[model samples]
Target: MRWHKRLLAAGAVAVVALTSAACGGGKVRGAEDSPQPGTSLSAADATFTYVPNLDVVTDWDPASSYSNEIIAMENVYESLTRYNPQTKKAEPRLATSWTSTPDGKSWTFTLRSGVKFHTGKPLDAAAAKAAIERTIEVNQGAAYIWGAVDKIEAKDATTLVFTLKYPTALDLVASAGYASYIYDTTATTDDLNKWFNAGHDAGSGPYTIDSWQKGQETELTLKKFDDYWGGWSGQHYSKIAFRVTPELTTAWQLLQRGEVSFVQRLNSQLFAQASTTPSVQTSQTPSFQNLLALFNTQSGPLKDVRLRQAVQKAIDYDGLIAAIKGSGVAASGLVPGGLLGNTPGMTPKQDLPGAEALLKEAGYGPGGKQLDLTMTYAQGDSDQDLFVTLLTSALDKLNVKLTAKPLQWTTQWDQGKSKDESKRQDIFIMYWYPDYADAYSWFVNVFHSAEPISFNLSYLKDDAIDKEIDSLPELTAIDQPGAEKAYADLQNKIINEQAAVSALFVQNYQRAYAKSVEGYVDNPAYPNVVFVYDLKPGA
Candidate 1:
């Protein structure tokens, strides 16, 4: 995941804006006696090691940590509710139960007692209220997820109520993995963010920070919290370690050598190998994530609709999918599969002739002036590299000159939002996943006209689109079919009618784990996140 920081003004209400940032089968190991709760065990059997294919912690502030650190943050922090894709419902976590008014404008929650943060402070409605207020006050990351809130009241020690300005799904909002975290609001540090960034944690989850080494192979390590409300009674790893391995092959080799218990992801070829290996297990779960190519509609040659459409037509969707060995499916629209607003049977196909004709009409082709364009994607992303390669090959037929460059995530995002229009890349490639499982995440962040320019890399400002996106939240809560139709119309207008962006494909979340690890499950709602607490050492 790639993300950056954005400052929100005092009184402006905008929809959610991002910073821009599985099943398995395998042979069982020899049965062994499982470790009981609070029992000591050896390092080999008690530790669960994970390897991530990139540098891990981009942000440390729980309210604003929206990047790859989510893999760790999810383990350290607890939210009021958690989305359970298996049951298609929001299950209880920090809160025991919740209810909403008939009009959906107000919600009340009953907090679970006997819970305590790492600081030994009791978890109560007042603490939860304070944590949420802090997030909303900072107004970074996905704080906009609470845009509908009119007010929040800590009615009692265990009761919290939320009054909304409009009808909204506050349950889904509370279940978000980003800014929805409930932490210790009574931190003694003058700056809570600085304290958190100094490798300290204030969460009440099942784990506590044991150690952190920046720019080292061992990025983070967490130990079990014996004081956790959810008592550790079953077989669970006592220690969790995350190591940064930039190369997928290196991670695979580590797994083969039994140096790590899990590999977050593997390349297609490596995944195929792991799938057949007798000692390894693999999972392939469809995700809410997708790749999007944002044309510089506000600047450069791509400003022309004809040129944008021509480039869209030149993309070989099937070729790109093949390049990844079917690890991903061609996107039907802006929304990915298994999400709302996704239009079935609408996958795009390359039209070389149509592209050439459009290029000619734009006065850029073999018979006209050559069009030169520049594209920027995250460095070290092999899939995006292949995407650029295939797209470059296709555009060569139309005599378009493409210069593709890879940059660090922060640098790439900064350049895309540069004040000087001429300095921005003509095409910005990025991966998008929802803050929550909602279509509003797409329209509000990427397509709804950027004012101070958040994640709308396209720099578009269409009032019609903005108005429609604004109505979606209310419509979605009140009327389901109407919201669906509105989302469909928005997708068609943006992708097919206006050629606003080039949506490439939706990828499947891939994972490989050692046969000894048990109770592994993948959820699309939180991509690239593993819930190690739910796992235990197999017998």
Candidate 2:
């Protein structure tokens, strides 16, 4: 996500003043304001606030939805299994431990003794099986994650067994996110599904929903779950407050005023100013995000591969970076650099001559015909505007007329997937941040033709590409070298075919907090994984 620094910097002083009012002069002397040193809180005491960019969360339903709101919801909800940021491994959350058959096609999990749901009902093996089954039976959109399951059996009150039709590496990753959150079976299936679909939320996590005012704020209180399998210790905060501030300037103001202890989504301008604030500290994490442009191949002139390739060649990536004025590397492949199968080197240069020739070959020339194109992006996102502006300027040099249309994030998302080809914009500028550290997570979901919600908005497909992706697991099972070779081959194919064009850029996650806040460290594996329990008042 690109943040415009100038806007943030200009509002920093006002934000700090506002934050002071919000905190009501509750000052943490030195780092002493941090939570009690070394004494961790149990589920009952831990709490904090997270300010998101959206006013209304589109999807909160775990089974069939996808959005950042789910990330915040994860704190209050418990999944069967959770990803351990420290270990980069999946660990038991609702389930105590799990085992897989030697053939890797079947598995079993044992629930912890005496676990209870937030509603005070006992969570037995039967309940666990029902939750997993409902995920498939009701939310078909999430079928890729749970549809492979052939059977789920309850072996008494404490044990659950799962049988899969095929081996899948996604089994663990899928369980760690909203895709596998366990819900109470006693509630109306429609109510439960509605909670997941709309912003209304219910979960078995450490926190419980206290109050949620859509597009404004969500408040949660730590619930003392004595029945929680994870032993509780003396934890930190007792409440969490999440606010939605779509304007970066407002978020910056809130942070400086102490209305919020921390602020994320910092751009270059905010980072620089926040770094100098005596009351604030700034830090960043390496992220698995890729900035790219999506071409609408179904209806636009971009339907011609040559025209698409020509447009790809016309982008001045370096110029775009300069416009943003930040520390981001130019991206060349769909998967950004530092990933398992990233194709090294900068994206091919803007070959103006080559582009012109390709356009001519595609029956478009200086006097041939002027193609009309519209580029759509999320409104209020300054970084996206920077990209669109730079690209439009470049296209102008190529004798192409481009119109820019900025829409609300939710509106743009809805239209981007509309079935009516004519209603969709000609081009889209967006980014993809991986859920886990895997090539398949990035490549398969985004490009695979089989994925119902394929991010491949381009609608590009190839049989060979499909076959190679399908055979990845088998190749990986045979040997590591073979798997590497297969992925490299895939990247090469994508580049050779001009499958999608993107400028590689440095992946970084930035956060700023008051000097009194402590225990915040960026996780390399999941950049967003900041355990609420880890926070304490600083000296």
Candidate 3:
């Protein structure tokens, strides 16, 4: 568990597979048949209710599914070496032990024994290979995580070896992170599209999707595995239902009335109310999500670095905080604050005069033509609307006209698609939730020059920064102080020298739960998201 900022700056977000299997069931009966006046229901038939942020989860395929928000992962699936949120370390889960060559290219993993899938099949090295290969074959949203994968072989039934095309820690951590959950290969079908979409997911975890209706609700039912090789992470519930409530008011009411047992996030007002409610309890975790206003560096007036810098400085981050009226504060860097490699001392400052000066240097102020920039924000989001109003007032001072465009999330995604000036975004407000708890997940995917326009919305490239980013893994491998220094240099370059981004505050996700629910662990590694495996009914 290397929690040190320097060495852990480069984390693993491999798009590989890590499977979990278990033993027989162990159910303990409770006093009441149903829940008492103020207690949890019987463990055997327990049910927890929730209001999910999403209307529906379109895909259940681990290889292709791309969701940055709350997702149902641990209960139904498992990974090789997951980042223990509590320890901030990549600890064993599916794969027991691992070793890498001196070159760091070839790595071997020892599989856990006697772990059988719910499909009555044993997960072996071959299953591990198939999981990695299928993810590559789908070539969907998550394929970028496995770009460096050169070769994979099952040396034996219990031994899995992975070889990388280039030397980086990505491959080593790939099998333990994001797209790394292993499926029961024995029950899988060749037609991946039909297989995943048809709900024939051969995962080997504690729970399975009992039923789901599009745009309605997803009901997950659990059955304990008596033969589980590695025991469950925490308390487990028998049933959980996730329903979508688009309105915050409706979701809040549902939680207070006991219709829903828990909610993943709450508004500031709702959070205040929950703390005072008699039948409710509240908890919060500072979200690791990096919200930013991404500027398209490839096109439009922003192509000039000076203009970009001016725009960055023109927006008053402090003003944004005052307007929002919440627990949030200014961001340090692209990586989340309160976490390793955040570079806490560095705060994004508003340089009004400097902004005007930079703009004039780029011929964007004074006697220049009127500058009208289109900034997109989520429609129906009151907080965003308020922020935009403040933004417009600020930009008005510089004689820069700021046009606010309110859009739905799907439409925003459609707009994010290209270098085509027609489709490229000028300034789209968005957030980057790391695939894993690592600085590389943010720096590489969001800011890397090597990434495609889809991944790197900034469409920026710096040879100097690129060279430093490339050497991060080796730097960390060599020594801690040197790695920290290297990361600091890059963080400074990206935030100050490049002036490629204007960061927003780190979010603090507030969750509300019914009085009967307990043992809910808010893993900051996954931000505000929750999995039923870590939560169970309580008195």
Candidate 4:
């Protein structure tokens, strides 16, 4: 993570990451796994493997790792609470139970006893307290997730209390979030950068990073932690490796060749092929993610509302979907369907003449004005080039010149969130996956002016919009009604105003796994979808 964070900023893509500079010197600490007490499962029952849709591991430290895929890190480090997919609630994992004050300002948790880290250090209140403090001190991108933490007190080995400055429902969300995972404080060092980044980790999960070959794969071998006090899930795989295969076709080929156990995502064009492939099965779950082209609303030619409208109207929404053979619904508002702020009926339709008129109105009509713009979309996204080609064709008809560039997902991601306005994208494409379970995760972080300048791709600040977004806390206190109204209103404003981005479709997230893999479960938090621990042999 960066050294300083100004609350959760918008990530270019759906990935969560902590970025840092410096490769320190130290063999990763906590490499020693003590014999766990209650684990009777053999290492073979815990073995698993798959190919990742993306290849990028930024940091292993939970406090600083911000890559979109943290399967290597998160799998090893267990949080105090974990997001329950079925209930969409934060369920206890490390802590046996917890309670918060009536006003929601203070929370106390009862830690489970007999739990120990890989280093044989007991999981206790002090370790939890220290980890939280270290995160704030380190100030990785994730530190802001716990921004409400005013103070944390360790009352005893098994009791920890957190006093917050703002009343929050974090327990139901943030408690199971990033940076809240307990670490083995006993293994901490002055040079933590060297410790966590050197392919080392500390956690009480069922797996450990046995080996990692950059640009190749991250192999994690596991054994049941008998001392684990939380519920265990997954096929008892002895090893799981995430090999780097950024292309969907390559992933599909890997499965066909018996080189991988599962492919986490299948491109729309290949969805049909997956159906008939021998020894393969596919799961189609609706994604809470949306593909969008964000504008640097803070400055640039896009500042004019008419130009924004013209840009929106020029693109063929349905054509883009057809070109890519995408499998999801066309998006309505900025927030995708299935969330609070989504407004379903607002899906955009192509209006080339409407766009031409708007461009002319904005003083950009053939010979009247020729607007030149640069657009970027991540490389390796299926049919990205086709979408760009169609968009370019429409723009050419409008006499607007567009320079389309394809960039690696990471490069485009960094450019999208660049702090320098000059360096940010005039328009860039990335998927927005819900950071947490609320609209606040999307609307506030992406558009709010108060957040770090890097994340507000639009660089917008409106008093009227701010007032409505500001009322979220109070509205959330009202529970469903308030949340529903506030989110719906926010999404409506964003859509009608042609706010910061050119919102597109929300696709159905689909993944193909070997027929032998049965326990694979879909998770909204992991945007590409599927958890490593849930897969076990099917009956």
Instruction: Say what the RMSD of model 4 is.
Output: 5.8
Clashes of each: 4, 39, 15, 25
Q: Who wins the TM-score comparison?
A: 1
Q: Identify the candidate with maximal lDDT.
A: 1
Comparing candidate 3 with candidate 4, which one achieves the higher lDDT?
4
lDDT of 1 by residue, 1-539 (tens): 22442211001111232121100011111113222223322335678888887656667788878767788888989999999987767899999999999999999999999998987889899999999999998888888999999899999999999999999888888989789999996765578876777666788898887766555576677888889999999788987878777688888887776677899889899999999987788999888888899888888998898999999999999999999985788888888876667787668899999999999988898789999999988776778889999999998888999999887666777798889899999898888888888878888999888757768998877889889999999988888788888988898888876787888988887899888888899988777788999987884
Overall lDDT per candidate, in order of appearance: 0.81, 0.59, 0.64, 0.66
* Model 4 stretches astray by more than 4 angstroms: 2-46, 175-177, 217-226, 230-235, 409-425, 450-452, 477-479
State the weakest 10-residue window (summed lDDT) of model 3.
1-10
Q: Write the per-residue lDDT of candidate 3 for residues 222-340, one digit (tens) a residue.
A: 35554455466555676766656667787788776667777776777888888899988888777676567778777888777787888888877888777665646678877676445
| Candidate 3 wrongly placed segments (more than 4 Å) | 1-45, 68-70, 101-103, 170-177, 218-235, 338-340, 363-369, 450-452, 474-482
Badly placed stretches (over 4 Å) of model 2 are 1-47, 84-88, 140-143, 156-158, 187-191, 194-202, 215-227, 337-339, 346-348, 363-371, 418-420, 450-454, 473-482, 503-507, 523-530
Q: For residues 440-524, what per-residue lDDT tens digits would candidate 4 score against the true structure?
A: 6666666667555555566778778788877775456446676777777777676567556777777676778777676777766
Model 4 TM-score, all chains together: 0.85
Cα deviation of 505 in candidate 1 (Å)? 0.6
**For each candidate, what TM-score against the reference?**
0.91, 0.81, 0.84, 0.85
